[model samples]
Each structure stands twice: as structure tokens, then as C-alpha cells.
Target: MILHIGQQKSGTTYLQEVLGHVAGPLAETAGILYPASIREVLPDAVESHERATSGLLGTEYPWISAERAADERAKWPRLMARVRAWPGTALLSAEALSTIRSPAVARVAAEFAGAEVAVVVTTRSLDRSLPSLWQQHVRNGRVSTVGEFFDLLARQRDRGPAAIEREHGLHLWRAFALGGLVRRWAAQVGPERVRVVVNPGSPPDLLWRRFATAIGARHCADLPSDDVRTHRAHRGLTHVEAELVLALNRAIGEAGWSRYEGRAIREEILQHGLLPRTDRGPRVAVPMPARKRVAAWAEEDLADLRATGVRVVGNLDELQCSAEPQDVDQPPVAPEEVAQAAAAAIMAVASRDRYAPALRRRGWRARLGSRA
Candidate 1:
């Protein structure tokens, strides 16, 4: 069975839809079976098997620091069992599972899948990724300012991968990015067995061709690059609008929220959704010095990171995106200070009171509640 683990938001959706929809024709030639409930049925097995051993359940979904889960997963042996059971290649695509959760998950997953499984993955630049990621979080009601957003970035790095995974649990990198995560898989599965695809906006059939080549399913006939239907992503939010929305998120506070209620915010973004990529709005610029500090940190990490066979798509120069430095030796921006300023600005638009209840309502507290 060949497993295609998605590193999320990395064209995995497009891949899933494309692969699934064409599975019939692909299977007819490739001789693989993608049963109707493939995505549903196996993930449970992965989860249940992992849960059975780890004894930890949902402190957070996609929890990577799940030592127990990892341990349990190592012991569960379902990937192996499934591999042993299946005849043709089995493709298990869980974007969340793409990261380096545990070396064991890769080892056992590939071991059981037989010597054949090649992990197919896609990646993008972090800068290009930030805007999309912010929009995604906001859709899910995670409203963090540019400064706080960077704060979390700094913290995540200091804490290490597992910690970050348990905390934020987004960033396809948490599951699979070209860093150690993919390296671990490649190391175990063999570099040849782990095929990394450059997204480069290839047409679906082209992508399918690449995938077919990787999975040894080249025989799966395909030439209809034109007939394939591609779903253009919904319109994106303007930079200002995105900032405004996330800022409003700070006002919601931890009092409470409804899952469905946020639909309006998303709908508004889509309805009015046009990403004026050039729409520059309120920016959170860190002092130049702080940027240097972050740059230093990243360089340190990069040193270690480079030692391993991992690929970093963006430059260290770009990695300090969160640090909008004023000077070459400044401290990172403080979120509370930023919150106070932002809240005050928001209050200016509210009724006469300097302390806008709405502003406080939407602050960090609200972010916490959303997380809760």
C-alpha cells in the first residue's frame, strides 16, 4: 500500500479530490483498490489504534506531542496489518499525519505497507503561507495580531516541535514540512520511496502523472489533464480586511462563542472575498534589532536544521517575518502593549469611552476561549 500523507494546505485537498475522483480509472489500470470509505475507515483505525496505546485523547486534535499517542501508535501495528492485508498499493492520505510525529509511525507505517509505500508530499514558502494560514485560523476563530502571531512563532520555536504540535497544531509543518518531519519519513521509507512534489501550479493531470510515477502506478492510464475540474479556492480577504477580522476576534473574549456563528465572518470574507494582494493595511513592524534577534535564532536553528537533510524553501532572511524590526538590536514587540494600542485604536471608533468593552472583549481572552 502506498500512503500519501498530506502536509495540509499544500494542495492536499486538490490532490485528494483528484486522486479520489479518478481512482476508478486509475485503479482499473493500476489494480489498486480505493474503497468507497477509504479516508473514513482507516483514519479511525489510525486514531483508535494510537489512542488505545497512548491513553491520551483529544487534549487537542492533531496533537503531535502525543508521546502516548506516538508510543501507542508504535505499538498499534495497524499500518502494518493493513499493509499485510492489502494486495495492491493502499493510499492513506492524512495531511495531519504528514509531520514527523514519531519515527516509529513512519517505520511501522512503511514496514507494514510493505517495501512499496512512497510518501508523496507538497510544500510552499512560509511568507506565501502566512496570509493563507492567518485566514484559515480566523475562519476557525483564532484571532491573533501580527505581533502576537509572531510571539507565538517565537515561543513555538523555543518550545520545540512536539510542544508546538500540542499547542498550535496547525501549520502543515507540524505534521509534515521539509524539515526533520519529512526527513524522518524519507530516512525510513528510503528517499526513492518518499517523493516530494513541487506544487508549481501543475495542472491536475500533470500532478496525477507525477503521483503515478512516484507510487509505481504509472500504468494507471491518464491523459485527460483538460477534462479534470479544478476547484479554484474561494476569494481571499484583503490584507486590511483580514487584519480587521482578526482584530475583531480580540474583542469577542472568552465569554463564549458558537461554532456556526463564525460562519458569517467566513461568508463575508468569501462574499466580499477578493485578496487585493497589494492591499497593504495596518502592519506590525518590529524594531530592526528585534528582527536581528529573531534572525539570529533562526540562523541557529538553521545551522542544526541544515545538518539534517531537510529543505527550507524560504531564506533565513524571510523567516524573521514576524519580527518587523526597528533597529538591529531591538526587543520583540510586546503583545499586551500592542493589544493596548490596538484596543485604544478600536475604542476610538466605538462610543465615547476610552476603554471599549468591545475592544477588551475581543482581546487575548477571546482568543483563548476560541481555542477552548
Candidate 2:
């Protein structure tokens, strides 16, 4: 069993996107089984096998209902039975698996008892992860400011593994505190079987090829890495667009929008609508003050990662932040820029058929206006 555990936002999404395409006869010829059974979870299981891992551990998310959780848990054992029966190599890639506790880790180890299990973890520098994570947090409907989010993470950077894992909302650290994550899996599967693939943040295929090499499937490395789906892979939101979404998230809460309604608007109107228009804008970079602290924290974590003796596939030095700290503060996102972003999102939403009716447009306008 090749278990691709993830440190989220570390090219995991792109890797999973590519894997989903080749998981059938294409992968079978290469002696890899990416498993079409992932579709059993349907609407939820699109790229990664996160739902299955969530089911196996019974991990609760903010969105999962008790009934839905029960159904997911029921599906896990059946999935494992099929995996156990497969004679050749089977691959299970789930970023959620990286966050499991010691007991849950043991449960995972026991579940795959008969197979030779190798664990693969993908990692990125702390500087790169923070901004991406804050955007994701906003996308999930939270209204925390990027500054507020980074400040909290900077303070918690030095905390012990167990301490950070206990707190909710610090999900990024629970997985990307590379030393702890690698050590935990190494303890269960042995250091030799634990492979760490460092993302170089460059030519896209480099990360894909490194990942394929980690899984001992060199042939799969040459497969197409492009995400050709109608809804393409997520690109980072520009500074102005992120702030606009943050503003909209606050409004959604003030208007008491239900979870489903907020999610739909976020995905359809803000994500698809507003985001595409702002690609040329500057991306949200790590704040000057936070960069030094994160660099120091990353150095400490990488030192510990080196001590784990697990095989590393790329230059561990690539994890370091070479940019020197600057004295200037990032310019505040301009009001006009944010307004333009909002207009773009509104225009995109207005163009869609489901929201094209004047009544629906008026309804949306009224809801947002009420909060204003």
C-alpha cells in the first residue's frame, strides 16, 4: 500500500487532480491501482480519498452532519476490504490522514496489516503555506483577516506538536509542522518506509515526477499533469479579490445565510465569478514582520525533519526562506480595487442562468443591502 499523506496546499491538490484521471486501466498497466472505487463516495470524493480517511477515523468537520458521518463510517470498512483483496500495488492518497492522532494512526496501521505500507508526505515552506491557508479559511466561510490569521500562527510556531494539534482552526500546523508529521508516521511504518517529497515551487512537472518517484511508479511520472477539467484547478486569489471575498464572508454571516447557501455563493459567485477577473493582480505575499518569524520556525522544523532519517526526495534547503525582511508594511488593499473586484464578481454572477432572473438578482441585492 502506498499512502500519500498530505500537508495541504503543498501541491497535493494538483497531484490528486492528475491521479484521478489515470486511476483506471491507464494506471493498471503501470502496475498501480489508484482505484475507481473512490467514486463510491460520489459528490464528496472528487480528487483525493480524504472522505475515506475521514470515515476510517470518524473525524468530524464543521460541515458533516451526524447522519452523514455515520454513512461515511459505514463505507470505510467495505473500501478497506476491497483494498485488502487487491493483489497488486494499491495507492490511497488522502491529506486528512496526515492529521490523525497516535491512536488513529495505530488504527490505520492495523487496518492495512497484511500489506507492505509505505507513507509519503508532501511538504512546502511555511512562508508559502500561510497566505494560501488563510484564503482557504475564508473560502470555507470564516471572516478572519489575513493579518489576524498570520499573527496567531506566528505566535504558535514554537509550540510543541501535541499542543498545536489540540487547538482547533490551526489545522495547517497540525500537518505542516513537518518534523512531527514525519516522525509520527515513521514510528508506525519505520523511517525507511516514510518518504518526504519537498515541493520546489517550480516547473509543475517537477513535483509530479518527484511524487511518482516516491511511490516507485516512474512510468506514472510522465503522464499528463494538466488539470483539463471544465472547472480548472484553483489559483491563488489576488490581494484585492481575497479582501473582497473576506468582506462578502462577513456579510454572509451578518445576513444569517445557511451553510449551504453561503457555500453555493462562495463557490459559484465569488470563486468562479470574482476570481477569474483578478489573475493579473499581485498575490498576497507573507507580511514583512511575519516572514522572519516563519523562516526561523521553518529552520527549527526542518532540522528536526533531518533527524528523522526518512528518505527525502528534494533539497531540504528548498524549504528555507531566502528573502530578507523589509521595513515597509504591505500597502493596504485599495477601496477602489476592492470595489472593482466586487463588480466583477457581481457581473459574473449576473451572467449565470440560475441567477439571471431579475427576481433572484434583486433578492441577492436585497440580502447584501440589508446587511449593509
Candidate 3:
């Protein structure tokens, strides 16, 4: 089976899209399969959990928090079994799985397939991951300020961060690290079997060529490479917007990201988050020290990765051990917030829609409103 593991926002979608050779495939020959079937049953399986965190568990996007216990594991095994039946290599990927902190989840995932697994995880640098991750934390209402967010993460290193993860129930550090994931998966498939798909800022062809080789896919050339940016969840929140949302979260504290009276207020704070992050904003800085400290863990984790003895496909050099491909802003809206805003935004849309009839005749002049 060809597994495309994701630490999220790490080009997992682009990689899958590339592998599938979809509208824009990655390699010319290789195929990447996504786990679409899981969606249907996943909702039903997690319905109980959703009851407690329904607003956060909306179907507009499939995101499961780390707090999910064993009972929360997805019900896509039957789908995977079908994918496994296929003759060619199958790529099953979910950024959510990247958050599987339990050693057991890794083992059970492999055991369910009744096969040894080859894990292909793509990674980027901490400098790059932060801006993306920070926005996600903001969206979830876990962080409030870039400086303060950095402080929280710094505490993870100095004062020790279990406090935050304890409070927030997510591990920004572990969840975002490929080597850390490799360590977990290695327990199930053996380290020699784990393959790390390098996130080089280079041309996709070269990267894909290397990735396929390490994974032993016969059709590497068949897959396509994508240069378009993936992991858009971290694209556009400006410092001001991020800080505003973070402040709201801080004030709200635990259950901050949760809906207040069925309304996702913090999410609204981030819905149009990219509007003001103009090119003229504060210049970017070198990643904080805590970021580098996180990067430091890769060396040991990677060593464990190589021990798996599985086919090492790509040019390891091309892979980014600790990357900084430039931090793309988080998406203007967090995925879940986008769904929530869609509901609350209808009034704004209604007001604008009134002009649609006349504007449809006028074209570009149509649909302007309160939120516009």
C-alpha cells in the first residue's frame, strides 16, 4: 500500500492531488489515492463525540481534535480494505492522522491493513510551520498573540509545554513534526519501512522523482508534480488579525473556540482574516528560538526513520529536514469558521442579493453589503 502521511498543511493535499495525477497530478506515472470514503462513516462514527463538540466537528471540513479517544478512530477500514484490494500502489492520507499522538493508533492502523506499512511523510521547517500553525491555533481559539503564542510554545521548551497541550489538548510541536510521526509509525511498520517525503522548495519533478524512489512506487513518472501552494489553512491572517483573534481566545479561555450561543465569534474574527495583511505590514523575522528547538528534535527522529530499512526512495538531500520555504499566511478564514460564517453571513448576503437582479444586468456592480 502507498501511504501519503501528513503532518497537515505539508502539501499532503497537493501530494495526493499530484499522486492521483488528478487535474494536476504530481509525477507522470505514480498514482495517489485519497480516503474519500471515510467521510460518510466518519461522521456517524464520531456522532457521539460531535454531540459534545458538534460545532467544532462540522462536516464542512473533516477535522478531529487530539482529544479524540480510541473510540473516535475513523470507520474507514472497510474503505481502506477496498483500496488495498486494488492492484497498484494506494495512497491513503489524512492530516488528522498526523495528530495521532498515541503509539497505539499507529499500530492499530497498520494492523487493520494486515500488512506492513511504508509511511511517506513530507515535512517543512519550523520557521515556515509557525505562521501556518499559529493561525490554526487562533482558529481553534487556542492562541491569541504571535508573541504570546510564541511564549506559550517557548514555555513548552523552558517551563515545559505540557501545560498548554494539557489545556488545549493539541500538540503543535509533535503534530507538526514528520520525524516525530516517523518515530510513532516505525513502531508499527518498523523504522526501515518508514519513508519521509521531503518538502524541498525545489521543482516538483526532482522532488517527486526522489519521493517515488524512496517509496518504491513503480509508476513514479506517471504521477505529476504541483508547484501551486498547498496547506492554505495558514495563508492570510495578519499580525493584527491574528492578535485580535488570539486576544478574544485568551479572554474566553477553555472552550474559547467553541460556539457561544451557537455562534462562532472567534471564527468570525478570523473569517475575513486576510483582508488587512497587506504587503506593507511588519516585516517577517527569523523564527523564534523555540522554533529552532523544535527543529532540533528532527535529527534524532530522522535517525529512527532511517532505521526502518524500508525502501528509501528520494534524494534525502532534497528533502527539508528543517525547512523555511517562506511562511504563507493562513487562509483568510479557518475552515470551520468558513462554514459557520456561511450561516451567519446570510443576512449580509441577503442585503447584497437585493441588487443582484439589477447588477446581473450590470455585472461587477452586484452584491455589496455590511460585511463587504
lDDT of 1 at 139: 53
| Candidate ranking (lDDT, best to worst) | 2, 1, 3
lDDT of 2 by residue, 1-372 (tens): 889988887888878777777677445677777765566547345567777666766643434556677778866776677677778888888887776666667788898887789999998877777678888888788888887988888667556677766654445576878998888888888999999999887766788789888988777665663543222355777677778888888899899999799889878866557756634367677877677777778888899999998899988988997458543234788888877777777876675566557657479777877899
What is the TM-score of each predicted model, taking all chains together? 0.58, 0.86, 0.59
* Cα RMSD for candidates in order: 11.7, 5.8, 9.4
Pitting candidate 2 against candidate 3, the one with the higher TM-score is 2
Candidate order by decreasing TM-score: 2, 3, 1
Model 1, 70-143: lDDT tens per residue? 55454335444554566676665655555435544544464454355566666533433444555666656677
lDDT top scorer = 2
lDDT of each: 0.50, 0.76, 0.49
Better of 2 and 3 by lDDT: 2
lDDT of 2: 0.76
